[model samples]
Structure formats: structure tokens, C-alpha cells
Target: DTAVSQTPKYLVTQMGNDKSIKCEQNLGHDTMYWYKQDSKKFLKIMFSYNNKELIINETVPNRFSPKSPDKAHLNLHINSLELGDSAVYFCASSQLPKRLLAGSYNEQFFGPGTRLTVL
Candidate 1:
């Protein structure tokens, strides 16, 4: 039973093509996140949803969007992908404590990332 799972673990597409990655979590967590890891292995949060409501949206390109139909799922869609869009996308879920301070970190369960390659 994978706590967090993503579809199409590997994606190779040409530049300017659009793509979407699906994510699901069976951990029953109220919060889910989409993170992008670049070639340098720097991870940045793209979006976060808590109880199906957008909470944290980072300053990613407008071409990226996150959709969450329910608390247990989050999908990322990228339009007009470019060469710089090539990276490993990760889906993570965590049960946040009631009072999360500015620097608080919750224990997150991450899915096997989807590696996207834009040629």
C-alpha cells in the first residue's frame, strides 16, 4: 500500500508540449503538496492544498497550475512546457499539526517522483 502515488513515473516530451501529472495519497492526510526539483536538485514548493483549498502557492511560472479535487489528491498541469521545465516532480502529503508556526515542518510522505524531460 503506497502512501503516496503518482502516475506515469517518467515523462519525456518535446518543448512547447503540455503535460500533466497525477498524484494520489492514501495516507488520509489533509494537506498535499507539489514540488519541483531542478537538475541541481533544488526542491521548491509549487503548490499546496489543505482540505482541497489552496493554501501555499509559490512563485512558479504561470504555465503551472495545481488542481485538487479532494483532500487526498493533487494534480499538476504545465502548459507550453519549455526546456527549463525538465525536472523531477514530487507529490507529498502530511498531516499538519493544529498550530503550525512560520518555520514548522510537518512529517511528509513523498511519492516516487515523475521525471519530466523536455527536449
Candidate 2:
């Protein structure tokens, strides 16, 4: 079973079109997150959801929305997708902070990746 899995591992989209990426984790983790890894190899966190609650990233654009149906799944929706949004999105699973005793600093288990290409 995949600890974390994101669908459509490769997404080729045109500018201004809307798209979505689904993510699911089988690890029974409480916290799920979205991280964007750009061409520069820098990883920037986007959103986090737990127990069907949304945790927004202050730097994330309003065009990006995250939905969580349960603790096992978190999906990302992008509206009016732009060229700037072209990057690899990684879904990750981790333990929630409050419930963690130690050694839990978002030590995430990442999915293979969803590569988004905007043209």
C-alpha cells in the first residue's frame, strides 16, 4: 500500500484551464499536506488538512483550494490555472503535532509526485 499517493502523476494543462489532483494515504495518518517542488528544487508547503479541516498556507494563492473528505484523503483544486502554477506537487502524510511526543517536525512521507505542465 502506498503511504501517500497522488493521481495523474503527470498533468499537462493549458493556461487558464482548471484542474485537480487527488491524494490519498493508507498510513492512517492524521495530518496530510501539499508541497510544491519547483524547478529550482525548492520545496514550499501549500496546504494542510486534518479531520476534514483546512489549514491554509499564508503564501498560497486563493486559486488553490484543498479538500479533505477524511483523515486518509486530501485533494487539491486549482482554478484559472496559470503558467506560474507549473511545478511538481507532492502529497505527504505526517503525524499531527499535538499528538506527537517528539521527533515530529513534519517528517513527511511523500508521494511519487504529480508533475503539472502548463502551456
Candidate 3:
């Protein structure tokens, strides 16, 4: 089984449209997360769900919403897509309070990522 999966590795859309990216993990984890990486390679945490509960919101725009159908899947829905939203969205999962401590890498793993392009 796939540890993590995200659909539409590449997404191209026009401005003002709605699009959704899906993610899933079979690792039996209670926490799942979404990260956005800009063209400059700046990684930022978007949303995190712990057992279907919204746990973290990193001041992301309202256009971006995250949904966890169950403990195994978390999907992202972008409303009114904008050029600014054209970035790589990655799905990840880990244990609760997951952190990459000093010199220590944790269990969190990322999906191949969905690259969004707005024109």
C-alpha cells in the first residue's frame, strides 16, 4: 500500500476556477499535513489535520481548504484559484506533535506533490 499519494502531479488552470487535489496515506497515522512550496523553494506549512480535526492553520488564504475524509486521506480544495496560488502543494503525514528535531528527522513523509500553474 502507498504510504502517501497525491493526485494530479501537475495541475494547470485559469484564474477564478475551483480545483481540488487529493491525498491519502496508508501508514495508519493520526496526523496529516499539507505544505506549499513557492517558486523560490520556500516551504510553508498550510494545514494539518489530526484524526479529521483541524489542528493548525498557518495564516493561509481562505481560498485554500483542507479536508480529511478519514484518518487515511486528506484533500485540498482551492477556491477561486489565483496566480499567486500557483505553487507545489505537498501532502505529508506523521505522528502527533511530529517534529524534525535538531539533527533528527522524524517520520513525516511527503507525497510527490501537485504542481499548480495558473495562467
Candidate closest to the true structure, highest lDDT = 1
Number of the candidate with higher lDDT, 1 or 3: 1
What's the number of clashes in each of the models?
0, 0, 0
- Among residues 3 or more apart in sequence or in different chains, the pairs in candidate 1 whose N, CA or C atoms overlap within 3 Å are none
lDDT of 2 at 2: 69
* Residue 104 alpha-carbon offset, candidate 1, angstroms: 7.8
Looking at model 3, which ten-residue stretch has the lowest summed lDDT? 97-106
In the range 1-119, model 2's lDDT, one tens digit per residue, is 76788999999989999999999999888889899999999999899876677765758889998988898999999999999999999999887754557766767799999999999
Error of 3 at 59 (Å): 0.5
| Candidate 3 lDDT, 14-62, residue by residue in tens | 9999999999998888899999999999989999998898989999989
Model 1 lDDT per residue over 1-119, tens place: 98999988999999999899999999989899999999899999889999888899989989998999998899999999999889999999999744587777788999999999999
lDDT of 1: 0.92
Best candidate according to TM-score: 1
CA lDDT of each prediction against the hidden true structure: 0.92, 0.89, 0.90
